[model samples]
Target: MPRSEYVASIRSRIGTDLLLLPGVTAVIRDEDRFLLARHQHSGLWSLIGGAVEPGEEPGEAVIREVFEETAANVRVRRIVGVYGGHPMMVTYPNGDQVGYVTTAYDCELLSPATPDLDELLEVGWFERDEIKTLPRRTWIDRVIDDVPRGSV
Candidate 1:
């Protein structure tokens, strides 16, 4: 998608006025490796997560989204932190805009299975060093570093 189209898509989703919505992001790790997805939207690597639907909690959203995108059953352990995407803007392919407030969590994989790639282009567990090398969004590095070092 072109940059202008992406920006327009984001604008449509968010509208002209900014809106704050609840979102969930999961940091699933095993043996010092974290699960990351290659986002289909912009081709940038990021954690598996999505918007928290009405009447749904952030943790619930993370679990559901992780399963849907990666097919890995996960249990959210704790909320690492909440981050605002105010300074940032996300644009979609259809010219929609989205302003996001993401609740990041430290989670563990409950099922010993590989991820199914429907929403995601690719999925894998990567070490911290490896994560640093991937073409990831700005928020990803902070999310990975904040994982309570040794929590996995």
Candidate 2:
């Protein structure tokens, strides 16, 4: 997984110190299905999203991330929740640590797309019940549980 230039620069100065960065998570729902991606870094399925880039709004970050990982365009409908603390802490294989203050959004898919294989192993829509059977981390479970069914 390639770190964003912004994150790379910060890591250059701080090394492996935990950086509390702003991030976003997109919970894109299209009727009975929700979008998910199998992230390369974690090798676990998760909601579509990524870091909130410098100067970008949280909503903008969600849109950018969703497109980058899934090649899917989306409109942020409403915030599902804000999350942080222990569950948001991440330590990469290289030992770089991060604590993300993430804004999870309920989004509406607006265009056709599929998983961007460069960033993800796979991407697909899943029924709510089907999510429990997918490979994921504990935090991923909590994030999915935070989203409401049907619509945001």
Candidate 3:
């Protein structure tokens, strides 16, 4: 399920027009490392996450996305931040535009396995020092910055 049926329907009408969407991101941690996945299209590494489905809570969405993208079961320990606004907006290669109001969570990883879905090219655990050097977007960096300050 690359894009949800609901989002697909909306995109059919709006094309590349920006959609204000709810999303969730997980900063999964084990010991001193955090989990990140390479986006299939962008090839940039970022935290595991995806759009929040209709009727799904942010916490539920992160858990689902973690398993869907990493084949890992995780429990949400706490929320790191609620980020939105223009800075978090994204334009996909296929001309799908979305401004995501994302709830980023600090999650406890239960397992490490290859993704069950095809959205990610690879997955790995990275220390904070290494995460700062990755070719990721500002939104992802913001999420990572909050991990040490403790989830708020």
lDDT of each: 0.74, 0.82, 0.82
Candidate 2: regions farther than 4 A off: none
Ordered list by TM-score, greatest first: 3, 2, 1
Give the per-residue lDDT digits (tens) of candidate 2, residues 1-82: 6698999999999999999989899877776577778877779888877788889999998998888877778888888789
Query: Candidate 1, residue 10: CA error in Å?
Result: 13
TM-score of each: 0.81, 0.90, 0.91
Candidate 1 Cα deviation (angstroms), residue 50: 0.3
Local accuracy of candidate 3 as per-residue lDDT tens digits, 124-150? 888878887888766787787777743
Query: How many Å off is the CA of 15 in candidate 2?
Result: 1.1
Winner on lDDT between 1 and 3 is: 3
Candidate 1, position 88, lDDT: 41
Number of the predicted model whose TM-score against the real structure is largest: 3
Query: Tens digits of per-residue lDDT for model 1 on 1-152?
Result: 22334445655665655545567898888767888888777788888787777777778889988877767798888898888764345766654566678998888888853555445678878898798898987777877777766645
Q: lDDT score, residue 59, model 2?
A: 95
